[model samples]
Target: MLQLCRDASGAPLAPQGSVVCIGAFDGVHLGHRALLARARERAAALGARTAALSFEPIPREFFARGTPVPRIDDARGKIVQLAAAGADLLLLLRFDAALAAMSPEAFVEQVLVARLGAREVWIGADFRFGHARRGDPVLLRELGARLGFGVEVFPEFLVDGERVRSSGIRAHLAAGDFDAAARLLGRPFMIGGHVVRGQQLGRKLGYPTANFRLGRRTSPVDGIFAVRVHGIGPVPHAAVASLGVRPTVNGTEPLLEAHLFDFDGDLYGRRLDVEFVAKLRDEEKFSDLDAMVRQIDLDAAQARSLLGVPEARPAGACA
Candidate 1:
């Protein structure tokens, strides 16, 4: 099992010593994975465990206040990816006012030294932490010298000579270039969550869907997508997904509604991962229910063709 801690101060987690990697790690993109892999290598060399330190609500999100900064992944997604990336222990700090005010020295002493007993700490070239973003590699080295830890800087990760960055991935997603985004992510961009009950309007429209609410998350992609729904069966199910506020219905919150072709099993509470394959169209307001349904028919047909789904199940079969 992967051990997780949220508080900044607590009993020592790795008394035997650990190699720690720290970052916001919003997307766990290719660059972030490189840093984690370096930590694993260092941990193995020193006979220590691997630990990853990150922040929830990511510092930028906390500082952004009411402004929603687009994120490639959410908290649950982060946890899942971090573990898969070889983090034996996860320190997901709550980034509140108290933590924001902590000094770089204090963070190293309390979190890295006292809590994790870190023998070596790995960080990306542009990493920053502590109050006012004062923490840097130089400051970290100074603290490490006095705190009995060593600091290593992971080189900037690149693919095809292009640097991998969260911002670049976001830009690709915004532009609906999913292929470019996936190159940086090292996998197809996806969103996973438990199905939630919506207004059931899709069912009334002859398209039953499994809904996932975005809550406070600001997603980079918003539109009709050709997607593959995972966790439904042995193979992914080809589907058409809508991610946005339903303008026609006057809905406000961002919701992901996936209508799986030929699927009729109950999915109200099942966890599903919707993998975006291609953007079909942007969300638009229609004049009435009839018009909206017509547009939806077109969108679904386009998605089915793009995903190479031989043919959609019988009409109203999913309903």
Candidate 2:
């Protein structure tokens, strides 16, 4: 079972001599994977379990109020990814004021030394923790030496000569460069949600769609996209997707809708995972329904071509 440690509350659990990596791991990008790999390698060598420690409602979210932040994945998704990466234990530490107020020494002594029994610690060069972000790689090394633990700080991971980072991935997604973002993420960017009812606007336009209510924290890629829908059959199907507040329809809440290339079925309440492939265009308003239909036709053609769906029908065709 996965263990989630929240705040320095109650009695500390006895350490099992684990090799751990610590980070926000927002996107679980290549950098995160590299750190995890190192941790896993060290754990195997030392005969210790591999674990990842991260915070929930990330520090930035706590500081940002309710403003929409560019999050590649939510806490649940982070845990899933970490577990898939061979984490024997996953700790979802609740980032409250009390935990945030711990001094560097206290954090290392209480969390790392006492609770986690960290035999080996791995992190990126830029990793920081403790009160006021005073804990750097050097500080961790110094503390490790005193605490009788090993510390490994890895150099930044690079892709195409550019350092792969969560911020860089967010920037690429914001600009609708899903392909570039995927290259850094080591897989296509995917958003999973349960299908929900919509205003039937797509149906009226001759293109029925599966509407999805994204999680509270999702990336800020608000635009039309070429996507692939998974969880329906042997292979994912090509799709055209829209993400954002529907300005033309005067919609308030953000919505994610995907129209499959050649699929016809009721998908209400079904879980859908949409893999973003390419950005077709930015969302725009049309003067009339006819104009909107025409633009959607063009968007569908572009999405199909980008997704390599050879038999994709035109926009107005029935699925």
Q: In order, what is each prediction's RMSD in angstroms? A: 2.4, 2.9
Worst 10 residues of 2 by lDDT: 7-16
lDDT of each: 0.91, 0.84
Candidate number of the best lDDT = 1
Clashing pairs in 2: none
Candidate 1, backbone clash total: 0
Q: Tens digit of lDDT per residue, candidate 2, span 136-207?
A: 989999999999998887788999998998999989888878888999998878988889999999998988
Per-residue error (Å), model 2, residue 61: 1.9
Scored by TM-score, the top model is 1
lDDT of 2 at 25: 89
Model 2 stretches with alpha carbons more than 4 Å out: 1-7, 10-14, 310-319
Clash count per candidate: 0, 0
- Residue 72's lDDT within candidate 2 is 90
The alpha-carbon lDDT assigned to residue 172 of candidate 1 equals 94
